[model samples]
Target chain A: MALLEIKNLHVCVGDKEILKGLTLTIEQGTVHAIMGPNGSGKSTLSNVIAGNPVYEVTEGEILFKGKNLLALKTDERANEGVFLGFQYPIEIPGVSYATFLKQALSCKRKYLGETPLDPVQFIKRLKIRAQALGVSDDMLKRSVNVGFSGGEKKRLETLQMAFLEPDFCILDEMDSGLDVDALRVVGQGVGIMREKCRSFMLITHYQRLLDYIEPDIVHIMINGKIVASGDKLLALRVEEKGYACYK
Target chain B: MAQKEIENIIDASYKYGFETDVETETAPKGLSEEVIRFISTEKKEPKWLLDFRLKAYNHWLSLKEPQWAKIKYPPIDYQSLYYYTVPKKKKNLKSLDEVDPEILKTYEKLGIPLQEQKALAGVVAVDAVFDSVSVATTYQKHLAEKGIIFCSMSEAVQNHPELIKKYLGSVVPYTDNFFACLNSAVFSDGSFVFIPKSVKCPMELSSYFRINARHSGQFERTLIIAEEGSYVSYLEGCTAPQRDENQLHAAVVEIVVLKNAEVKYSTVQNWYPGDKNGVGGIYNFVTKRGLCHDYAKLSWTQVETGSAITWKYPSCVLLGDHSVGEFYSVALTNNYQQADTGTKMLHLGKNTRSTIVSKGISAGYSNQTYRGLVKMSKNALNGRNFSRCDSLLIGNKCGAHTIPVLINENKTAQVEHEATTSRISEEQLFYCEQRGVNPEDAVSLIVNGFCKEVMQQLPMEFAIEAGKLIGISLEGSIG
Candidate 1:
């Protein structure tokens, strides 16, 4: 069974339609990349899957692990092992990164009918995962993403994905605004998280991210629909052809 | 915001609205010279005190209730309120055990145990004032050993008359405002603390005020004096029982910090905030101020989450050279509640400094406002003041306002003010939710973070409780 299945999804932001008749599926153990131009609905697809209320799913069916994902709230989808790496991470002024992650992890544990991690164990696991993502201990102590540079914010997002260990991860523009060194670090972080039980969907406008973590399948999205589908060669082709043919 | 979501936020009921079933004595329902005389006689106050009350009574009679605050309410019927009431058993109680069991249970229900054994250990000394009098004061003996005079205001009148006479109404004169004059005339009981020169208080001193008598107005007076080179930290918590009629609570708090002394005052006010339609609740109008002498410091931290209509400004006066003043506050108004609160920082001495941090959260149909004033006198060379006020609106129906006044009379004085009003963004909420936190908890986390600066100023023990109060006040604010 597919880890994530979207059938004829239609999403609208206010009166304007952003995602029109979009359909895709990702099986377990596969990393699928979606390449699209600006306003091509790549970010909208990730946001709709995360159940953001602003983007109304006018008509759609989202199935995750054979369950109706659209009927669930954002947090419920998260508890079911679905993650959306935000394109723009928010700056919550007073909430420390450590505190936020602990509460998030506790919520997931409660949903899974498992005992919550004690403070000692929680801190231990957080430090270990954050270190792997090259996140400084000082960053965790600071307000969540407040005053973080572009690279620091992306690294924090990857660190969160690593900590949650979600079964299906959606990286939305995760490679944007990152320097080459930072991009390599974030890519390697994602590369290390790949497992047989997990699936990933990388959404981006460029194919440079694919050079670090190669994709099993790449799809081209244009004008709110997937126009083409192929393997890794599709991303390379777009990088060279500049999406003029798809237009 | 959906109608259902707004309804849920409005239905977040008050948890500390249970009445104590205790027999009580109450004064006649009226305000007059006779009422003031009656109260003075009942407490066996000195002639000077009675004279002071009479002067304030005449002054109060000539003044009208101020209507300048950004809050609306039907005119308060001062004549219809019982000016004084006390539990009958309080006159004969010799110890905590001898006090009324129902009263003890009431405090326990409010998460404050009155019994010495079950109380919040030695870290805090509490003076629990119920209705019109202090019922039980814990850790008094321990505090007394440190030369820290902590007791009921009525007791201070009898035991430390000199100190009370010298500092009472000194910071906030009796004729400062209409409500302050009323409180001076009929004030019943509140905590009084005095730290002698060079003495550092060993534990946090606290006063818990509970308004229990029906139709009874609670007028409490608190006075704290930190002598030269002394230091103290004080906390105050207040709650009232639910009733169908609005209750009047007018209080006056004054603190004096002498040369090189320091004092920290914190208040967590969780009074009943009325019903969904704003039928009944407390009209909390208070005057709290402090004066800092040479090289002294004074800080005020308050978390206000209750009262149907609140009009209070806890202020500081930097009167001495190199003195410092700070005000940190988090005021939340939900349902039909209204709050107009902030602080005043006056720099009169050279090189004096002050800081103000105010955060307001408005939910449901409530309105929250931050009104502040920062003034630096001409002689205040190199004086500095920084003020920041932030407002967070939960639902679309509520309102948040910031009104700040800055007066810099000296060229060398530096004053900076920043204010921002924002709603909890959908993206921020979704980000938290997508991390597995529920919506309610997500709101709490973001709000707590928003008010972190003020919360950090609170003492460790009170900080925990204040955080919980913030969460409770914002319950159901999000759909």
Candidate 2:
């Protein structure tokens, strides 16, 4: 069985189907990249997986570590070690980043039947994770993405992903707004967390991210379905030759 | 979710409503001259007080309950309510130890630990009033040492008659309204605080009013007088028992801040919110008014979250030049509660300034309204006023309204008023839940955020309880 399996998933936004019979599978200890042009339903797939209420799954089976994933609520899926790095992270005013992250982390720990870290222990672990992602103490004190710059928000998302330490992560354009330096820091964080029990699905349009965090398999998605699959060089080919080759 | 239900054990309707089974001192069940005499004679009050009560009672009998407020309720049977029920144990009064544990437990249940704290340690003296009498008062000597008279209104009538004679009915005349008139006649007990001239009140003064009787009405009359160049902050909290028969609570509060003096009054009202079906809630019609006499200032901050029906408008009269007035309020109504409360700022002083920030939250078939008035006189040249009223509706069946009456006469005055009514969007709550916060916690977080602008103005202790009260009041408001 695949570590994360998507079998004939069909998702609809309102009355129109967005994800049409899409299927994919990734084994543990591997990274898979899904590259697509605009209007390819990449963001929709990430949100549907994260349990966005707007998207209705008409038909699908998403299995995460042998458990049915589509039946869980968004928070349940999160506590079950499924993380989604949003393309546009929400700006929640008056809610401090530290408070939000602590609650989320404690919730996940509680779901695992593990003891929640005391404030002191939690803060100590938070500083370590935050430092690994190049997050400043000031960022933790500020409201969640309230006035963050574009690069800072993407870095925050990366910091959240690192702090969560999920079994699998679907980065939805996580590298979109990052500068070269920020993207490198995020890539280094991801590389440091890469292990045999962890898997990642990188969704991006550019090949620059693929260069830093190389994927074992690169799939080309078009009009809601994966049409092409290849190794790392396929991303380079698409980067230089454009998506017209896959189309 | 089951854990949530268990944790909500304390979130049950205001539980301090235990009516003492013993009855000794009681007045006739009606607002009559005989009842006023009965209360005055029971307390051994002087003839002057009996005359005062009789005069006010006569005026009350001639007037009718005002109908201008947006609140509509079943006619209150004034004749059926036992207006006065003082505890018979006051005959053995001594120290805090002599106080009844049941009365102290009432405060403890209300989250006010009043017994052990050194009375003089804090600046605010608390007068705990239960049912129809003052249960206990703290920091009497300390307040007296500073020439600040702090006691129950009945005690003040006997001990500090000169101050009462000078300031009573001055700010809020007995003829002001029906509630005020009735309170003037048969008001059982409330706090009376007086700060002498040029003295800064060392502590906050507070009165906790608990309605323990079922059919008996609570008519408290609080009067705070800040002499020239003095300053004081007073707080009041009210709670009632759960009952199926509607209870009437008509209170009158008056404050007089003299020249160059400042007074701040804050209230966190959590009366019994009738059952989900709106069966037995309190009808709260209160009259609170302040007068800024020649450069004095008065500010009112309130967090109102209970009552089946609330009709109040704490107002200020700025008569002094350069005087200031402010009103910050957050009123939440859920599960059949109806609240029509706000403030009235009348600027007669030159260069006077006023700000009104009112927030209304309505859910579960409840209705809330922010009705405020800003009246600027012709002499209010260079005066400035800013008013913002925002309403948040939780369920589709609830409603929120903002009615701002702005009367601007001076062209030089700058008056800006803004109002917005919005529903608690699914996006906001979902954003919180996505962070692993449960639905109830998410709703509370958003509601707290919305009311932070007003809650921040509350005192440290009050701010914490007010936040918790908001969370508790919203227990079953959301699914």
Candidate 3:
């Protein structure tokens, strides 16, 4: 069974249709890369799947692990092992990164019917994961995303994906604002998370991110629909062609 | 979620609205010289105190309620209200056991057990005031060993008459304002603390006020005096029962920080706010002021999340050279509640400094305002003040206003003010929700973060309570 299945999804934001008709499916233990130009409904699909209230799902059904995903709220979708790495991570003043992640982890644990991690125990795991993702202790102490550079925000997103250990991860332009060195760190940090046999969807405009994390299938989205789906070579193909023919 | 669903959640969410039923004594349903005499005579006050009350009452009769605040409510009928009420008791209790079981249970239910055995030592010494009288004060013996007088206002009048006569109404005189004058005339019972010279209070001194009587007004007066080179941290919390009719709570708090003394005052006023339509709640009109001597410091941190109508301005008078005054507040109003609260800093000493950080969160059609004043006298050379007022609105209809008045007579003084009003960032809330925190909890976290500066000013234990109180006050504000 597919890990996530979206059938004929139509979404809108304030009567302006963003996703006209979109359909996609991701199986377990798979990496899917979505390549799309700006204003091609790629973000709408991700937001609709993540249960963003601003995006109204006019029609269609989303099935995650054979259950109706549309019936759940944003937090519930997240607790069901779904993660949406924001394109431009929001800054929350006065809320430290460590505190935010702790609450997130506790919510997931409670949803799984498991006991919350003791603070000492939780800190131990946090330090290990944070170290692996190259997130400094200083960043963890600072307010979430406030005053952080682009590379820093992306690194934090990678760190969160590591800590959450989501089953299905969606990286929405995760490689947009990263330097080469930082991109390597973020890509590899995210690449290693998928080594545990989890599924992921990487949305990027370039094929550079594919060098760090290989994709099993790459989908090209245009005009609110998936235009084509192929193996890794298609990403290289789109890179050379510049998406002019896809229109 | 539908709009009606959100309204349902907000209207039905008042966890601390339960009323405690106990036999009580109440004065006549009117205000006059007789009521003042009745309150003073019932407590067995001396002639001087009665004369003071009569003078304040005469002054109060000539004055009218001020209308400068940015709040609206029906005219309060003072004549139709109970002037004073207390839990009926046979005699003064020597021990906690002698206290009424029902009253003891009421405090216990309110998360304050008056019994000494229930709480570990070195945490807090509480003087519990119910309605209009002090029920019991714990850790008095332990506090008394250090030459500290931690007792109720009534007890202070009896045991330490000199301190009561010397400091009572000294910082805030009876004619200061309408509410303060009313409180001076008819104030029943509140906490009184006198820390001796050069002694640091061993434990936190706290007062818990509960208004269990219906249709009765609670006018309690608190006075604290920190002697030279002394230090003390005082905390007070108040809550009232849910009633369809608005109850008046006009209180006056005065603190005198002597030369080289330091005092920290914190209040978490969680009076029962009326329902979504503003049907019933407490009218919390309080006047709190402190006087700082040479090299002394005074800080006022209040977490006000309750009360249907709040009109308060806790202020400080920087009197001596190099004195410091700080005001940190987080006033939250929701569901038709209205709050107009802030602080004032009067710099009279050379190089005196003051800081004000106010965070106001308004939701559910409520309105709030942050009104402040900073005045530096001509003699206050190089005085300084920094104030920041931030307001966060949750829904579309709620509003937040900031009004700051700063006056500097000294050319060397520096004053800085910054104000910002914005809706609770949807991006922040969505980020939290995307990370598995529900909308309600997300709102709470974001709001707490918004008020983090002021909340961090609170003491450790009180900070946690204030955080939770903010969460509860914003319940059902979002779906």
> What does candidate 3's lDDT look like per residue over A1-247, in tens digits?
5899989888988988888778999999999999989999888888888887778888988999998999998899999989999899998889999999998998888988999769998888989999988888888999999999999898899999899999999999889867897788777777788754589999898999899889999999998889999999999999998888899
Misplaced by over 4 Å in model 2 are A1-3, A105-142, A147-149, A176-197, A211-213, A240-247, B1-24, B90-92, B118-124
lDDT of 1 by residue, B1-479 (tens): 33234235335567898888899888777988888888889899999999989998888889999988999998888889999999987465678888888888888888886677776667888899999999888988877888889999999999999999989989999899999999999999899999999999998888999999898999999999999999999999999988888999999999999999999999999989888788899999999999999999999999999999999999989999999999999998888999999999999999999999999988889998899999999989999999999998887888999989999999999999998898777778888999998787788888889999999999998999888888777776666
Q: How well is each residue in B302-363 modelled by candidate 3, as lDDT tens digits?
A: 99998999999999999999999999999999999999999999999999999999999988
- Where does candidate 3 stray beyond 4 Å? B1-12
Q: Estimate each model's TM-score.
A: 0.97, 0.91, 0.98
* Inter-residue clash pairs, candidate 1: none
Sorted on lDDT, highest at the top, how do the candidates line up? 1, 3, 2
Largest TM-score belongs to which candidate?
Answer: 3
Which residue pairs come into collision in candidate 3?
none
lDDT over C-alpha atoms for residue B264 of model 1:
95
Q: Which ten residues in a row have the lowest lDDT in candidate 2 chain A?
A: A86-95
